[model samples]
Target: MYGLIGKIQVVPGQRDALIAILLDGAREMPGCLSYVVAQDSTDPDAIWVTEVWDRQESHAASLTLPSVQQAMARGKPLIAGFSERCETVPVGGHGLATVP
Candidate 1:
């Protein structure tokens, strides 16, 4: 399984709008096992996004999806910067169905 964890900092007062865009784009992602958007506990302008996919290629392909592309275009102006991004290989986890 492939996973990504990213920290995004949005322009002040724009976090909720950005989060809404992300959530909308995440819906119906092919091969996506999980996708989560979280608010940073200590930073008002920071948000965390975590995703799990069946393959790295699927994750990459999602970038070209129309919804994702639209979200990127709409959210670009609200984004301040990215703080951290980490890629991972997930073995197993709760809520993720195990493949035989």
Candidate 2:
């Protein structure tokens, strides 16, 4: 399994709009095991996105998807910057199908 955890900084008061775009794009992703978006507890302009995929290739391929491309286009202007991004080899998790 493959995973990614990242923090994104968005323009002030635009976090909700960006989150909506992200969630919409995530809906139909092939091979996506889990995708979560959360607001940062201490930062109004920061959001956290965590994703799990069946394989690394699936993650890479998702980037070329139309839905993802649209989301990127819609969300790009709202983004201020990226703070942290980490890649991981997922083993198992409570809600992840990989937990078998």
Candidate 3:
């Protein structure tokens, strides 16, 4: 399984706007097993996203999709910092498969 945690920092007051774009993605993107976006109470401009994908390939491919691309475009100007990490799990919790 593949799980990703992404932390994004936007230029002040931009988090809500960014989160709105991300929320739009949740409606139509494919191969997404789960997704959550949150605002950091300590840092209003900071946003956190956690996503679980059926496979790493689906998640990776999503980056190139128009929906995702558009979302990113809306967010580009707002971004100040970003960090992402991915993990693989065999069992016990949420797990993802390799791209087929």
Candidate 4:
């Protein structure tokens, strides 16, 4: 699986519009299993998106599409800052019980 966790700083009053675009696209993304978008409880302008793709290829393919690119373009103006220091997560590491 492929996943990402980061914060997208959106312009005032434009968060809703940006999220709508991302969520809509995620649903249609070729390998997307689930794409979750959330707002920071402390900051309304801070947005977070967690995406899970069936495989690495699907996520990569989505990046080449026009609609997805356009969605990003729409938020370019609203973005005040971006936490882009994300990395590829290890596959199938979920639900491993850790000893407390």
Candidate 5:
């Protein structure tokens, strides 16, 4: 399985809006196993996004999806910067289906 974890810093008061866009875009991801958007406990303007997909290609393809593209465009203005990003290989977890 493929996964991504990232931290995005948004304009001081725009986290909620950005999160809403992300969640809305995530709803129809074809191969998505999980997509979580969380607030950072220590940073008022920071959001953490974690996503899991059936394959790396699925994750890559999602970037080209119309809903995702629209969300990115909508969220672009609210974004201050990307602090960090990490790519991961997922095994199995409670909410994720087992994979070889």
Candidate 6:
């Protein structure tokens, strides 16, 4: 499985709005196993997004999806910058279905 964990820095006071945009695009994604958006405990303007997909290609393809594209357009202005990003290989975990 493929995974991505990233930290996004939002414009001051715009984290919630950004989160809403992110969540809005989280549904109806093919090959998406999980898409989680979390607030950084210590940084009001920082958000964390973790995603799991059936394969690397699926994750890449998701970028071109209309819902994701719209969310990116809507959220662009609220983003300050990206702080960090990590690619991961998922094995097995609760809430993650076994993809055979």
Global lDDT scores for all candidate models: 0.90, 0.91, 0.76, 0.73, 0.90, 0.92
Poorly placed runs, candidate 6 (over 4 Å): 97-100
lDDT of 6 at 67: 96
Quote the lDDT for 38 in model 6.
99
Worst 10 residues of 6 by lDDT: 91-100
Cα-based TM-score, every candidate: 0.93, 0.94, 0.81, 0.77, 0.93, 0.94
Estimate, for each residue in 23-100, the C-alpha lDDT of model 2 and write its tens digit.
998877888888999999999999999999999988899999999999999999999999999998988868874321
Model 3, which residues run further than 4 Å from truth? 83-100
Which ranking of candidates, highest lDDT first? 6, 2, 1, 5, 3, 4
The better candidate by lDDT, 3 or 4, is 3
Q: Candidate 5: which stretches are off by over 4 Å?
A: 97-100
Considering only N, C-alpha and C atoms within 3 Å, which residue pairs clash in candidate 5? Answer: none
Q: Candidate 1 has what TM-score?
A: 0.93
Which residue segments of model 4 deviate by more than 4 Å? Answer: 88-100
Model number with the top lDDT: 6
Q: Residues 6-92, candidate 4, lDDT per residue (tens digit)? A: 788888788888888877665467766656789878888889887667777878888888878987777677788886536456466
Error of 4 at 90 (Å): 6.0
Residue lDDT tens for model 5, 3-71: 999999999999999999999987678788888999999999999999889999988888999999999
lDDT of residue 69 for candidate 1: 95
Judging by lDDT, tell me the better candidate of 1 and 3.
1
Go through the candidates in order and give the C-alpha RMSD of each one to the true structure. Answer: 2.2, 2.2, 3.6, 6.0, 2.4, 1.8
Whole-model alpha-carbon lDDT for candidate 6: 0.92
Per-residue lDDT of model 1, residues 1-100, tens digit only: 8999999999999999999999998777788988899999999999999988999998898899999999999999999999999999988869874321
lDDT of 3: 0.76
lDDT tens digits, residue span 1-100, model 3:
5678878888887778888988986665577767789998887778888887777887898898888888888878988988655475424364432333
